[model samples]
Target: MLGERILLGPGPSLVPPEVTAAMAAPMVGHMDPDLFPVLEETARLLRQVFQTANELTLAVSGTGTAGMEATLLHMVKPGERLVVCSAGFFADRLIEIGGRIGAEVVRVEAAWGRPIDPADLERALGRLGGGRTTVAAVHVETSTGVLHPIADLARVAHAHDAAILVDAVASLGGADLPTDAWDLDACYSGSQKCLSAPPGMAPVTVHTRTRGRFRPATFYLDLEGLWTYWGAPHGYHHTVPVSLVYAMREALRLVAAEGLPARVERHRRMTRALWAGLEAMGLELLVPEPHRSPTITTVRIPAGADDAKVRTRLLREYSIEIAGGLGPLRGQIWRIGLMGYSCQPKWVLALLGALEAVLTAEGVRLPKGDAARAAAARL
Candidate 1:
C-alpha cells in the first residue's frame, strides 16, 4: 500500500531511484571511521545545494520543524524583537516559535495568495529604530504557493542591521536561492521537498553573523553542537540517522550533477506546463503569475466540486497523490507539486489527464482531453 501511489503532493515529493538506492546502500556505526567521509561529503553537497560556503552548513537530525526550532533557539533570545512576514501558514510558524521564545513579535501580513510586500517589511523594520532585529520569511509559502522576495527582503533587513532567516522547506532545490549572495544569515530546508529525499533530515546553513553560541538553552537542538558533530572533533551530538544522511548526500550529488540553474529551469518549465493544463481546463491558479511557486501550484477548486472527493478520486482511482490547502485555504485550493523527480513531463501529463476525468465525473465541466493537450503544448 505504501508504494502503490505516485507522489504529486506538496512533499515529500517523488524520491528518485538513485537517492533511494543510496539510502539502502549500507549501514555503519555513527562513530565508524568509514562514516566520516559520508558525513563530510554530505556537508559539502548540502552547502552546494544550500548555495553557501559557510563551514557550519550541515543537516539537522529531524524534520523542517526541528530545523526551525534549532534556528530560533539560539538567535531569538528572550525579550528580543523578531519580525515575520505572515503570508501563509508556515510563516505563522515563525510567529508561534518566536512567541514561545519570549521574543517581541511584529507581524507583517499580506493576502494569502500574494507574496509578502517588501515595502511593508521595510516599514515594519523601520519601526524598530534601526535596532538589530531578525526577519523570518518562507521562501515559498506552501499553503498559498507564493514565492516571497527573499533577496530584496534580506537587503532591507541588512540596511537596518537585522538578520534574516528563511524557511525554504518547499523551494530549496526546486527554485533558485543563493544564500551567501543574498546575505541570508540562517536558513533551513527539508530533505522531503526539492532535495528528493526522505523527510527526517533538515539541511541548515548559517553564516558567520548568526553562527550562534555554544550549547544554548536546549541541548538536543543546539546548532553549533550539531555542527561540531557533523564537523571537526566529530563529537556525538545525537545518534545520527545514517541512512537519511546517505540519501541526502546522494540527493545533493544528483542536484550538483544536474546543475542548480538547469534544475530550477526544469522545475519552471514543468510548472508552466502544469499551469497551462490546469488553466485550459478552466481552473484558476490561486496565486497569480510571476509570484507562483515553481515547486508547488495552488489551483482553485471549481464551484460545486468537493475538494476532498476530487482528491480522494485522484488517489483512489488514478493512484496519484496531491494535497489540499492548509489553514484558511483548505477546501478552496488543490495544491499540485511539481518538484524534484516529480517535475517531469510524464507526471504532469498524467496528473492533468486524470484530473480532467475526475473533475468531469465530479460535475465540474471542462473541455474533454484539453488539459493534457494544453500541457503538451507548453512542454
Candidate 2:
C-alpha cells in the first residue's frame, strides 16, 4: 500500500533504496569507535556536497528547523541588530527566530512568488549605517518555489561588515550552491528534501570566521560547543542520532557517486521538463522562470476549480501526492516537488500524466494529452 502512493510533495520526498537500507545497518553507540568513522565520512561528504572547505560542518540531530534555530541562537545575541529578507513563509521564519533571540529584527519584505531584490538589501544595509547586523535570507523559498540570489545578497551583507546566514533547507543538494564561492557565512539544510534521506538530521556548516563570533548559549543546540566536542578530544556533547547519521552518510555517498554537476543537471533537466509539461497543460506557474526553484514548482489552480478536490482525486484515484500552497497562497496553487530520488524522468512523466487525467476529469479544458506529450518530447 505504501509503495502504491507517489510522493510529489514539497519534502520528505522519495528516499532511495540504498539510503533506506543504510538506516537498517546494525546500530552502535553514538560515540563508538565504529561510528566515529561514519561521522567523519559524513562530514567530509557533506563538505564536498556543499562545496565548502569549512571545518565546522556537521549534522544536527533534528529536522531543518532545528538547524535554523541552532545557527540563529549561536550567532545572534540579545539586543543585536539583525536584518532579514523575507520573500515567503520560510524567510519569515528567520525574522521570527531572530526576534525570539532578542535581536532587533528589521525585515525587508518582498511579494510572494518573487525573489528578494539585491538592491532592496543594499538599501536596507545603507539605512542601517554599517553597524553590526546579522543578515539572514532564504536561499530557496520552498513555499513559493522561488530561489533567492544569495551571491548578490552576500556581497551586500559583507559590505556592511555583517555575517550572512542562509536557509538552504530546500535547495542544498538538489541545487547548485557553492557556499565558499558565494561567500555564505553560515548555511543549513535538511536531509529529506534534496539528500533523499529520512527527515531526522539537519546538515549545517559554519565558516571559521563566523564560528569565532558565536558564544555558547544552550548546551545542546550550541554549535560552537558541539564543534569543540566533535572536533578536538572528541568529548561527548549529546547522543547523536546514530541510525539517521547512517542514512545521511548513505545519502551523501549517493550524491558523491552521482557527481555534483551531474546531480545538479539532472534536477535542472527534470524541472525544465516539468515546467514545459505544466505549461502545455495550461497550468500557470506561480514564480517566473528566472526565480523558479529547481526542486519545487508551484502551479496556479485555475479559477473556479477546487484545488482540494483535484488533490484528493490525485491521491485517491492515481495514488499521487502533491502539496497545496501554504499561508497567503493556500488553495490557490499546487506545490509539486522534483527532489532527490524523486527527480527523474519516470516520476516527471508519471506526475504529468496523472495530473492531466485528473484535470480533464474535472472538466478543465486542456489540450488532449498535451502534458504527457510535452514531457515525452523533452525526454
**What's the lDDT for all of these models?**
0.89, 0.89
lDDT for 174 (candidate 1): 90
Estimate the overall C-alpha local distance difference test score of candidate 2: 0.89
Q: Write the per-residue lDDT of candidate 2 for residues 1-379, one digit (tens) a residue.
A: 3556678899988889999898899879977877777888999999998899999999998999999999998678878888999988998888888888889999988999998999998888888854568899998899999999999999988988899999999998999999999888899999999889989899999888876665756778889777765564567899888889999999999999999999989999899999999999888999999999999999999866789999999999988889999999998899999999989899999999988888888888887878878877876
| TM-scores for the candidates | 0.98, 0.97
TM-score of 1: 0.98
Tally clashes: model 2.
0
Q: Write the per-residue lDDT of candidate 1 for residues 107-136, one digit (tens) a residue.
A: 999999998899998898887764558889
Task: Give the C-alpha miss distance for residue 164 in model 2, angstroms.
Answer: 0.5
In candidate 1, list every pair of residues with a backbone clash: none
| Clash totals for all candidate models | 0, 0
